[model samples]
Every structure is written in structure tokens, then in C-alpha cells.
Target: MRAYERLLKYVSYETTSDESSETCPSSPKELVLAEALVEELKQIGVADAHVDKDGYVYGSIPATKGAENEKAIGLIAHMDTAPAMSGANIKPRIIKDYDGADIVLNEKLGVVMDTVTFPHLTNYVGQDLIVTDGTTLLGADDKAGVAEIMTAAAQIIEADAQAGEGSAHGKICIAFTPDEEIGRGADRFDVEHFGADYAYTVDGGMLGEIEFENFNAASAKVHIKGENIHPGEAKNKMKNASLLAMEFNSMLPPAEIPAHTEGYEGFFHLCGMSGDEENAHLDYIVRDHSMDKFLERKAMLERITAYLNQKYGEGTVTLNMKDSYYNMREKLESDMYIVDRAVEAMRENDVEPIIQPIRGGTDGARLSFMGLPCPNLSTGGHNFHGKYEYVCIQSMDKMVDIIKTIVRKSN
Candidate 1:
């Protein structure tokens, strides 16, 4: 099947990940799509196609004739859609040869994607654009990547069959992981079993988005233990933890935040804050590109706990810090061909590569730390993880070309 058809069919599955769950996949619905994709991979002539217990589908296409000894190239995409929106029964619309105007997604709901709000729509004039009906997310965030990999795998096999001896290709491996939206996609991933020299997750945004660098991440959870006393005479005795949480937030750099910083700028974003007089909590994710800034972000949190302890006795503020992921650029820089191949493939296919540091983390960021040295490629998607998500069918077709080029150009 074509990439567009594959995307439409895959999005039909309600594979929304759940962040609250403790399971590997975090949701049961992802298995529905995982099984379906395993069948699809086997139907496409993939050998040993199967979904593992952790809900990852892994398969391989053996190298052909002269390319048998070539390095293995892996292409990966996520099975679960983002947990931020609904992925149930998505109604996608195809606007053929778009006229460069506002797109009305739902007539009765008055939901539309205005060109004024999304000026990027102007770039897709006269191309096939697939949009949602404004009720649910389009799930194109990674399904577009999935379809592109599947289609490219089929094309590689077809080309080998048609070209006879020397024109086949290297070993191609593909995997569809689950719960990537919740940051657990790589937790159960078996890198050694996948057996690729390096890999690429086609999970980034836009057509030419190539991400080699991302923030080294750490999550901070602050717990404030307070003494709730009578409000009548509670000047020095009534220590409100809620007020302390606010004070903790105030200690961070006011200018350094996600909304205020971009492009190598580090920031401490307060994702959550809650509690009352007795207890309070603060959740933050610290991000930075530099190791020094990354360490400083962690140290800043530690300093806050120390300051609060000195003021309100020894064990008042408790901090729990956990490392999320690190910058993949350090590992990716060692082998720059992974990025160079993507840029060359985009240039050859009439798409200019947009090389930028991802403001957030991706599955590739963790995969790189896991010894794969993976980089990220684009899925030709925009406004992802929400109701306004859309995918360009023409760009999805071009992504197929990019993957095919990567397959043929593998050294």
C-alpha cells in the first residue's frame, strides 16, 4: 500500500498512550495497532515479523546480493499517539491540490484552520494535505513516520527484485515502539537484538526537520512539609508550604523559561505546583544543551532545598531529582553521516533540510544514550499532539523518497 493509505489506516486505531499507567506500553489499545503492523510487515515480505511482549514490533529485510555485507540501517517510529489529546476514531480529510486558503475542518463546530493563524499552510499550496476534523488528533505525529518506513521497505524489496544482482540494498531493520509519548518507548527497547549499527526515528516535525541536538533533561519533584497551625496566632508557627512552593518557584531565573528561551537556551519550567498549609509540591523539568548548564540546573534545585532547610529546620523541603535524557549531539557528532544523509536526501528530493535543536526530547535522544547513536528525521507533520494536527500527503510521499535514498546510499 501507499504511504498515505498506510497513514490513514494506522491512524484509525485508537493508540493513545496513558501517562498515568506503570506498564511498559502504558495502554492496552496500542497492542491493537502493534499486531496490525506486524501483519502488515509480514505481508510486505519482512522476515521474522512479530510484536514482542513489550508491544514493540521488530522485523528485518536481509541484504541483497552485493549489499549483504553492508552496514545495517534501522528506521523506527512510535506506535502510540500522544497522551495530550484524543486518538479515538479520527476523521481525517484530504484536501487535494490545496488552494492556499483557510481550511474549514468542521462546519457545525465552526472549527477551522485559518491561514492567518497558520501561515505555514501557504507553503503547501497545490499539494495534498490531510487534516483532522477538529474533534480528535490526526495521530500523524508518528504514523506518517511509520507509513514512510513501511513504504520505503517495500520499495527497497521491489527495487532489489527488479534490478537483479548488484542493485539490491543493505540490511534494513524496522521497529514500531509504543508509549513514546510518555517517554517510555525506549525503556524496554532491545537495542542489541535489533542489530543496527545506528538508527533514525522519523518522529520530528515538518518536512525537513533534522534534530541531532536536544536538551539534557532532568525532572525535579519538591515536597514541602509544613506545620498547619491556628490562623489566629500563626505568625511564626504557621508555616504554609504552599507559600514556600511559590517562593521556591521565585528563586529560579524569571527570564529563563520555556516561553522565554529557545535555541540552546536552558530553562526551568514549572510544570505543576500544588498543596495547602500542611504539604506542598512542585514539579519542574530542567533543560539545557550545555553540560555545565545542565548541571547548574540540577544544582539550582539542590540549592533551593538547602535554603529552605536552613530557614525552616533541617528536613522541611525534600527534593527528588531524576535524569530523563541527555543531548544526543555529543554521540551523533562522532558519526555525522547520519545527519548528512538526511540533508542530502532532502536536497535531492526538492526539500530543504531544516537543521535545528529540538526544544524537547525525542525517542532518538534516549536511543543515542543507549549506544545506537540515533538521530531524528521528519515525519512531515505539524501542530502535532493536539486537535489541530495535520500531515502533508505530498510530503509523506517525498519522505518515502528520502528513506529510499538513504537505503540506497548506505555505506
Candidate 2:
């Protein structure tokens, strides 16, 4: 199948991962798509295609004849969609030759995207686009990446098999992972088993994106214990947990938020907060591109909590903090060619490479630290993980070309 064809089909699988689940795949639904990918990989002539017990699909295409000496290159994409939104029953609309205007997703529901906020629609004018119906996310975040990799790999194999005398330089390793949306995508990746000299995760948004670095991330949750009293007779004896939660938020830097920060800047995002008198909880995610700054942000939180406890009481607050991932640029700096190949490939294809540091984390960031030296490439998506999600078909086709050219020239 073609890249868009595979993308449309993959989105129908509804592999939405569950962050609350204890299973390796997070959600068993992810395995449904993983198994299907393994079958398709085999159909496309990838040897030993199968889904591992941990729900990762691994496949290999042997080197084409003359390209036997080239080092193996790996391409990866995630299987599960984000758990934050509904991934079931996706209705994808293909806009043929898009015109820059307000797109009415569901006419009766009165859903429309303001061009004022998303001016990038002008960039995709005259190109075909696939979007959601405003009810659920389009699942294009990484499905487009998976589709591009699968189609490109199929084409490479076919080209090598047809012209056996002039093949690419080496074998190609491919993987489709589960639970990437939940941050455990690389926990059981088994990088040594995939066996590639270098790799790229086709999980970025927008065309021409070449991401070598991303935010250093950590998640923090604070549970506040409060004394509840009857509102009718409430006085200094009562401490409203909800109000305390608000006070806790107020202690953090106001300007340091995702809505305000961009491009190498750091932020403390308040993901969730809940509870009332007697008990309350606050959830925050801290991110930065620098390790020292990331640590400082976490320490600042600790300091705030300590001060709060000093005034309110020692047992008033409890904190849970965990490090998510670090910047991949540190690892990629030693082997910059991984990023250069992607950039040069875009330049060779007449595409202006948009090299930027990702404000969010990716599977590649953690994978690079795991010794794969991976970078992120574009999957041609926008408005990811929401009802406004969309993908450009032309960008998907171009990504396939980029992957093919990389393999053809790497040999």
C-alpha cells in the first residue's frame, strides 16, 4: 500500500494507549495494531517479522545486492495514539487540493478552525490533506510516521529485488512501538536486537522538521492534606484544600508556562488539580532544554513545598516527582551526522529544513540516551492529539522520497 493508504488504514485500528494501565503495552488494543504491522511487514518481504511479547513489532529487509557493505539504518514509529483523547472510530476526511480558508469539520456541530490562529494552512494550499471530524483526534501524530516508514521500506525492498545488481549499501531495520504516547515506548525497545548503526524516529510534526534535541522532562504531583470544618461554623480552624491548591499554583512562576514559553525556553505546566477540604492534589510537568535548568526548576518546586510546610505544618504536603527524559542533543552532538543526513536529504529534495529544538519530549530523545543515537524527522502532521489534527498527503509522499534517497545514497 501507499503511504497515505497505510496511514488511513492504521488510524482505523484505534490503538489508544492507557497511561494508567500496568501492562507493558499500556493497553492491549495496541497489540492489535502491532500484530497487523508484523503481518504487513512480512508481506512486504521483511524477514522474521513478528511482534515481541512486549508488544514491539520488529522486521528486517536484507541488503540489496551491491549495497551489501553499507551499515544498517533503522527507522521507528509508534503504534498507539495519545490516551488523552479518543482514538476509536476515526473518520478521516481527505481534502483534495486544499484552499486556504476556514475548514468546517462538522457543519451541524458548528466546528471550525480560525485561520487567524493556524496560519500554517496557507503553507499547505493546493495540497491534499487528511483531517478529523472534530469529535476525536486524527491519530496522525505518529501513524503518519509509521506509514511513511513502512511504505518507504517496501519501496526500497522492491527496488533492490528488481535491480539486484544495484542495491542500497546495507540492511534496513524497522520497528513499530506501542505506548509511546504514554512515555514508555522505549522501555522494551531492545535496541541491540533491532541492530542498526543509527536510527530516526519519524514522529515530528510539520514538514522539514529535523529535531536533534528536546526538553528535559519531569512529572510532579503534590497531595495536600487539609482540615475540613462546617462552612456554617468555619473560621481559622478550616483550610480549604481547593483554595490551598490554588495557593500552591500561585507560588510557581506565572510566566513559566507552555502558553508563554517557546523555542529552548523552559516551563512548569499545570496538567491537573483536584480535591477539596480534608484532601487535595496538584499535578505539574516541568520541562527545559538544559539539564542544569531542569534541575533548578525541580528544586524550585521543592523549595516552595518546604516553605509551605514551614508555615502550614510539616505533614501538610507530600510530593511525588520522577524524571522523564533528557535532551538528545547531548548524545547526538558526538555523532551529528544522524541529523545532518536528514537535513541534507531535505536540502537535496528542495525542501527548506526547519531545524528546531523540540519543546516537548519524544521517543527518540530517550532512545538516544539508550545508545541508539537517534534523531527525529517530520511526519507531516499538525494540531496533533486533538480534534483539529490533520496531515498533508504531499508531505507524506515527500517523506517517503526522503527516506528512499537516504537509503539510496547511504549505500
Find the candidate with the highest lDDT and give its number.
1
What TM-score goes with each of the models? 0.96, 0.90
Worst 10 residues of 2 by lDDT: 160-169
> lDDT by residue for model 2 over 1-411, one digit each (tens)?
679999999999989999889998998888989999998998888878999999999998877666667778899999999877899999999999999888989888997976887889888889999988889999998999999999998888788777755455577889999999988999999999999888999999898999998999999999999989999889778888788778888999999999998888999999998898999999999999998999999999898889888988897888899998999998999779778888888988888899899988888888898989899999999999888899999999999988877666452
Each model's lDDT comes to 0.89, 0.89
lDDT of 1 by residue, 1-411 (tens): 779999999999999999899987789899989999999888878968999999999999888777778778899999899988899989999999999989999998999999988989999998999999999999998999999999999888777768754346688889999999998999999999898887899998889988999989999999999999989989879989999888888999999998999898999999998899999999998999988989988998999899989998888899999998999998888789788877887898888999999888888889999988788999889999887899899889889999888767454
Candidate 1, overall lDDT? 0.89
lDDT of 1 at 112: 92
Model 1, residue 142: distance off in Å is 1.0
Cα TM-score of candidate 1: 0.96
